[model samples]
Target: MELKNRHKKCINFDLDTKELLKYFPKGTRKPYALIKEFFEKQGFDHRQYSGYISKEPISDYKLTKIIHQLSIQYIWLKNCIKEFDVSNAPQTLSLKNQIYNSIEKEENKIYNQFIQKLRYYQSKKKILNSSTKIKYEKELLNLYQKLEKNHINLDEKSLKSMREIAKTKSLKR
Candidate 1:
């Protein structure tokens, strides 16, 4: 394994549909079918990848951008899934509304807590040091994560996505 045996070669690689799902959840929550639906909804001809995409030689930089975009799309799709899904399901909208209300309530509750704590400190004339501020920001993020797990608007799709994003558990459990 000396420098005399150095190798500097890049072989051709073919991308597949699996590449599109590369950023998606890895386990049962991968939501392959749902992601496929999202691809179709976005008018991405993934099937054509086999015919044209694989045949073409993409630059390393371009391929990196493509994969990065796929990851972002996974995030965008999950966040917006409930909005579109809720619109599609009109029959039991009341239940959906309840979920939405609960989500809103949860958000407000957290916001109120933050404000109250801030005011309490202000009333005491206590200075919020840098470390405390950073800790507070992390705490806020944690609370928001918890609320969103019930999912934004408290809908099922968002909940599923949240579960996928969560490192601690999966929806399967």
Candidate 2:
């Protein structure tokens, strides 16, 4: 299995599949199979992969798609938190926080790459006017700002709250 041989496929099962199956009857065999294929393709241990696909650097297009999907999930989760009863609030919030952490991690990874690219562009002897450079700088700034806006910050306080909620939920169970 080589890195070049790995192809993107729809995954059906994830870490939460078992929990989700309690609510929905259909299992995600297709997606899970796809993930298994990816693991095999990469010569990784499928049992340990945990379905986190972006451990290696991904293409910009794939990154964009992931960010978009995460953003949509973030919005939906926020709405769910707002609308759900207090009894279920902790679980929803914990899930939301987890998603937020993922988004932030991805953004930070991309941001470092973005800066490296910009630095490389500067080091190269390319034809550029001051106006063009300014335009490029503004565009980069805008991209950073856009990513920042999409990121959800889960502070220490929130983590404490989530932990408390988890404990309470476990006690109830």
Candidate 3:
């Protein structure tokens, strides 16, 4: 500590740092390789990893509380994933199918409009002019924004997220 503080410019910690940080890993450079090494150490194929970790309840309450509170914008996607897990009823299936169709149609319409614009540009033998390029980028951004809006709907998702956060706060008290 004194050497590091005194010789801050030279920074002569190469020898002492190893002894200090020996408890914690110093190397395993890449994250992916580290993850792979961890799984391999855990014998992931043999399910030995379960023994090292505490058991969690098989309930959506925790997931909902965590994901909804922290990542409000992605509440719909998490809800959709939860819905997919145990969607058995005919009504549920029909509703999911209807939603899928609606989402598909909207996405297709946006894509088709962009395609038409591209075709118009092609038809005119234009070499991607500035205004046309701007329009292209605008269309792409519009499509992305629409999809994000669809996911974070006020009544369906964002409201639910707020309610979930409130529920957790109440529980904590």
Task: Put down candidate 1 lDDT per residue, 1-173, tens digits, no spaces.
Answer: 34333222122223233443555546424454555554444333344221112223334454356445655866634333322210111121127788879978877886566455444433443476756754654554465565556543444543453344343233324
- How would you encode candidate 2's per-residue C-alpha lDDT over 1-173 as one tens digit per residue? 44453343322223455543443357745444554664455433343334323334334455446546544633423322212110111111127788879977888776665465455445541576756755655554555455447663334553353345346446656
Instruction: Please report the TM-score between candidate 3 and the true structure.
Output: 0.25
**Each candidate: how many clashes?**
1, 4, 0
**Highest lDDT scorer:** 2
**Against the unseen true structure, what C-alpha lDDT does each candidate score?**
0.43, 0.46, 0.38
TM-score of each: 0.24, 0.25, 0.25
Please give the TM-score that candidate 1 achieves against the real structure.
0.24
Model 2 segments more than 4 A misplaced: 1-94, 130-132, 144-173
Error of 1 at 147 (Å): 9.5
Task: Note the residue pairs that clash in candidate 2.
Answer: 11-31, 12-31, 12-32, 13-32
Clashes of 3: 0
lDDT of 3 by residue, 1-173 (tens): 22222210100101222332343356423322433344344332212311112122223343334334433532323322211111111121127788889988987776565456444544553477767655654554455456456562333443453345346446656
